[model samples]
Target: MESKTGTTRRDLLRAAGLGLTFPLLSACGGLAGGGNSSKNQAKSALKIGFVSPRTGAAAGFGEPDAYVLDLAKKSLTSLTVNGTEYAVQILDRDSQSNPQRSAQVANDLINSDQVDLMLTTSTPETVNPVSDACEAAGVPCVSTVVPWEAWYFGRGAKPDQKDAYKFTYHFCFGVDQFHNMYTHEWPQVPTNKKVGVMWPNDSDGNAIRAALGPLLKQSGYTIVDPGAYTDGTNDFSAQIAKFKAEDCQIFNAFPIPPDFATFWRQAAQQGYVPKIAQIAKTGLFPSQVEALGDIGIGIAGGAYWTPTFPYKSSLTGVDSKALGDGYQATGKQWNQQLGPSLALFDVAAAVLKAAGNPKDKLGVANAMKTLSVDTPIGKLEWGKGPNANVVATPILGGQWIKSTDPKYKVDFVLVENSSDPNVPVAAKLQEYKP
Candidate 1:
């Protein structure tokens, strides 16, 4: 897959004016497609723009992006659509973990590059803005990694509306899945059922506070929310004090990595220790845990993708174990984001083939509206409920412990799978001592 860096004035005009694919894309200009319009308009190249946070705070979500892109480029040398062959170009831009940059790069991809489909992942900071840009430009977009509700509702897609965003589609776990996993997983730690929450004043934080908080309360767990705080707040003293006062044994948070690290270190210093500190978003990566030293061990969180999964990548034909092993061959630790990063391309391949004519924007968008495709994670089928545009994937609960292997310093052991029976529990849940 070729990357788009820039285009000359002539190139821009040609890209802007052309109703047909570039001449270089056509393999002998074979007439391939069923419909008359498709026969007349089967373009040669399909361009997809990918947005992610390759730098800044959320960089962990994008560390393996380049490796995954290389894998996709190798696997998908060219796509055979109908009877014609079409080369694929994936132009990726880093959001740098900033939302405004996300919107700006997405606009550039949509306007300058004239991408047919847009695929973005990481967090709402990246996904929401990119999706918004796609929705406004009438481009087809598929995003994962962000919570379904945060992407769906956080972007001002009304809950009561019959149709959510028309151009963008998302696939990730939702509040219901969080409720199911939390209710099942937390009971194993022998806590008092009091959950001390630090939901930030952001997209992910707001949605979880409004939705997951209530579910936890209804499930007989007392909630100790300290209200919403701004993202880079240094002092968590007041919040820690309250949790200590209430004897909150189960700590829950949905914050950016730095904020979480700061709060966690402060909590340890102030003696507001909990029995089960279940963190989301921040604790998914091994690097995040490694940064905390011994304090990070025994901390629990959800696993969106692990080597234990039985699913295989459609493009690479490598199962979860092989994918992990392949990445580790580079002497780097395996990350949870690897599966989702490559899965974005997997979804792109599916929709491109389903579009009939890869050049047709509206047709490709419509195809993504109801798509069932395989990825490194699992089968992602849209048009099911949580919302019309979302597919809730399985999230397994696990804890970070000292690694038994020499190659790694920490290991994540899956302790609960009631949310997903297909994945077996890796080990028993341990109570938090630090």
Candidate 2:
């Protein structure tokens, strides 16, 4: 967990398939401010548990999240709240994208590790149980990647149940936001182009499909029967063939990393190049594009942050170039720049500042409820009105611009910069498919 002087060493390790590991409390000693009673410490060190998929099909996204958490934790040592020093202890567990395993990890983090707060980016199936555990324990949990709608309205209601979850907070945009962006902006896209969507058969996929139905109807586009793939399936040739049969002009894929890479590569191999290709989650990380090589060229999707975007906030001083450079200096190639992680950390900082003490979970949750801080993305305030879940925040979008510079050897474009979460759908969906 030692911070490298530059990102180069870490990048080399990541490229070599050697994942980074955080130092355990026993090994790090008092460096991370652990092993001391809250009363003995000037400001209690907050132990924030993170349950993310580190060694699963979504590792491309999960790994960067873990790295971002590490960076955030290191950054916190230098942060001061009202001139009082504070520290952070990040307890990380890999969910492996399995619901049962994720539940075990959740229970351990909450009941055994006694974590003050927890952060998650699990898929819908895995997230529900964990959210239930946190809610029952009265622990504050923040999820950066879980679709907001699923958490707000439980997966199809049972015969006799209300659809709502009270304890989980969503910090990222929901599927409705992304779907609205596309549907509202369809008028801007040339008419008569066939739209082929390939979404996973899960809660995330269902949500997108539910939103797409009304949007496509309103936009006057012929929706080719979308193809559905199981979450971990590799072969997409049959699905691609269906799009080819429909003479698909635009392709929208919502699969995770390796599958996304496989689909894009196969599409190119089969000469199935759409006029414009759009991917949902693939563009979020740089590694996904890197894994696909030239196959990912011209692909557009919404992302949280990128190097080209302006950071219009006092929290980070508004210089995105320096942040990108610092990330590059770590020896890691700046691909999917860590947008959500940075924003989440800023939120964590706000929570700590408001609580005035890290050991108080209830006090921290109350403080979070009142916080309205400006972040690198934009000003974020907890949703406080009646019927508000209190754990979710607005989402912004960015594009991936292809970079050819040898200094930055990556081919992805972040054309659309991150905007405020509430940007009108028409404005947010400005087409970048060309």
Candidate 3:
């Protein structure tokens, strides 16, 4: 193997006193060191593989992917590394929101496409399996959106394991975040402090059940767990019946999107509506709640990203307002995926440049281990994160408020930002009347 050692982009830029900016690889300008023609003539180019749930129950997460990818393509078409201009190609695949399929596509990217780096996001179903594949294949990977505790322990990793997977790095909130977002919202409404928790047998459900349930108990609230059920259980009558029997005034759940939609409708029909129905792993997006019609109003969940967030994209220098405005201007609703998806590319581009050798997988992996850069969500400090290979993003409380706006039938307002005060609170907490 050729020697994979040289100056990193961060080193060169800092030496010149230029902070992290994308203008170094300007779209209209020629290559940094060599001309554009030489970049095309390079024998090998840097390859990046992106995987997400584009066409499945969780497809809402990938709705803004195309726009973000288009932005990435334009900004990352070419870059200068160690005085050599290199062409960059990004390969995207749909995980279909299935763990098995996620692993398959990830394997193809590593072995077949020989991707120099891998990036996956959205949820544990997409992030965990893809990260596992990258770890087994020894390919450097980065992921986002999934709760950190779920991504770490959900993969059967222990808290004492430390750096369980070196080649894979993740950035997202953790179980503590969910607890914070929930406890902050639950007390706003009058209740008996009895929380009805519906945790399934899946990764998210198991992790939340283990951590979040105890936290609620410690906070002097009674937790009424109905036990773990399968993912696609058509009937939640038993669980609903238990909550109703216990007179649970506050409801919490971590379930798949479709499963929550089914259980939510059933709960309403069965007259088991709680004063505060805070859900996780589902109902984060507007479209998901829109499916619930008016019942979606007053439902609550955690928010990691929002159009109203006060942050900017490192790639396009686009602030949260511009990013959301651009999407809305194009006839598309704003989504949480926009920030993290663009952040993935921002981190990817930074990792590739910091690697000093884009073709060397080990070098790229090492670069990702300590890489830190500002993103549309905020500054991501991978090195300062919870684990050696993780960065904990902020999670705030939010609710879906009734609205007649055409852009969105219901408005996803930020109700609590105690965890991340930088994000302004958009509305006051409203008790769930359903």
Candidate 4:
């Protein structure tokens, strides 16, 4: 893995195209064990571990994680809780999106690197072992992309099975959110009621299917024949033909961004536009929007946060604008999908602030359980039900309306807001027409 030296505060602002005059670099004295420091003060050099695949197939996801972590570290120093000062040090680990490598890297972070906390993107194949390592070490892990069920139910073993790993927490809404959007929301479209699903035959796809398959039948929806496909089989023409044969009305896709784009182009070329299509994840990133061009229009999808939604102005006395602005200044776009990286930072910040000291993992864990920090996405509360880490955050359903601006190719129409946990799944279904 390639590593770079840490940047100074000034360098970060310059990279973000912002002007900075604050003497933040010199303000480190308080954090560096200077005057009036207590003898038992927590170690000043606070280190947080960041593990992501910065070099493999998921580099698109991993690179942004690293960039966003750097951005958050730079800005979070200005944050304080009850007059306590803290500094963030990031240790980068390249998991390369492999399970064994992810486990090894996670073990290193917990055992040798002495990371106060761990931040990671969860893949079903990779996250389980890493979660086990963290659980064993008593480390608090805040995963940006791990699905809610992985943290809630524990993936490898049955929900009732013993020896289940339970140290990690999911910071983002996972397949359950997707299932809610599809089973509950997509049915609302009166014209295009039929559902067609095309997913990769991998662990990620299986997890999604496991959650949605049973629900689809229970919801009285038609499951088109020849549903799922394995990875590396580029041609989706056969599957498109099946959808055409089934007269599928609403096309639902869960493939990765590149495969999703290819499937979309193939479907378009085959004259198979299913009144409207609802896609998840990869389809919502800015890169997908730019790559697919006009072919990407009219597609509806769910997202955690968007620049479009309104959030609380005050978040427990923290400036929400500063957080949002810091994120926007980084120049990363999420198609319509809100990057979970920012949410992960908020989770970390919440734990850090509540703990008052950076070195306490148990304190961080307890703080996370009760955290209700407001973010640009809205007010977030960790689910206090059976599941601990899964929070009831807002998921927005947006349309890819034709762009009015020549420079920008597409814009979003906020069709409906699915923020409320009490909002009936049936009602969300009724409102979310593709």
* The best candidate in terms of lDDT: 1
Off by over 4 Å in 3: 1-44
User: What lDDT score is found at residue 108 in candidate 1?
Assistant: 97
How many clashes in candidate 1?
0
Q: What would you estimate as the lDDT of candidate 4?
A: 0.62
lDDT of 4 by residue, 283-343 (tens): 5555566678777767777666555445532322224344445455666433322345556
Candidate 2: clashing residue pairs, number: 20
Give the C-alpha miss distance for residue 173 in model 2, angstroms: 1.6
Per-residue error at 382 for model 2, in Å? 1.6
lDDT of 4 at 430: 26
- Candidate 1 lDDT over 1-434, as tens digits, reads 23243334465456547754343223223223333445444366678899999999898898888888889888887899899898778898999999999999999999999898999999999999999999988999999999888988899978786467778888888888888888888888787888899999999999998889888889999999889999999999999999999999999999999999999999999988899999998989888899998899999999888888888888778788888889899888898888888888888888888989878888988887789988777899887756668888988889999999998999898888866787879888889986
Clash counts for all predictions: 0, 20, 0, 4
Regions of candidate 2 where Cα sits further than 4 Å from its true position: 1-45, 65-67, 78-87, 122-129, 154-165, 183-191, 312-319, 356-358, 384-387, 390-402, 414-434
Model 1 ranges with Cα > 4 A deviation: 1-42
Stretches > 4 Å off in candidate 4: 1-42, 53-55, 62-67, 78-86, 93-101, 122-130, 150-154, 160-166, 174-176, 183-188, 225-227, 312-339, 383-386, 421-434
Per-residue lDDT of candidate 3, residues 1-434 (tens digit) = 21133445565466457553334333324246444555556535888899999988789898889999998899999878889887889999999999999999999999999888899999899999999999998999999988898899888788788788879999998878777877787777889999998898988888888888888789889999989999899999999999999999999888889999999999989999899998887898778988898888889888788877888877778888888888878787787788999999989888888999887888988887778888988898877878888899888898888766765687788888877888998777789985
TM-score per candidate: 0.90, 0.75, 0.89, 0.74
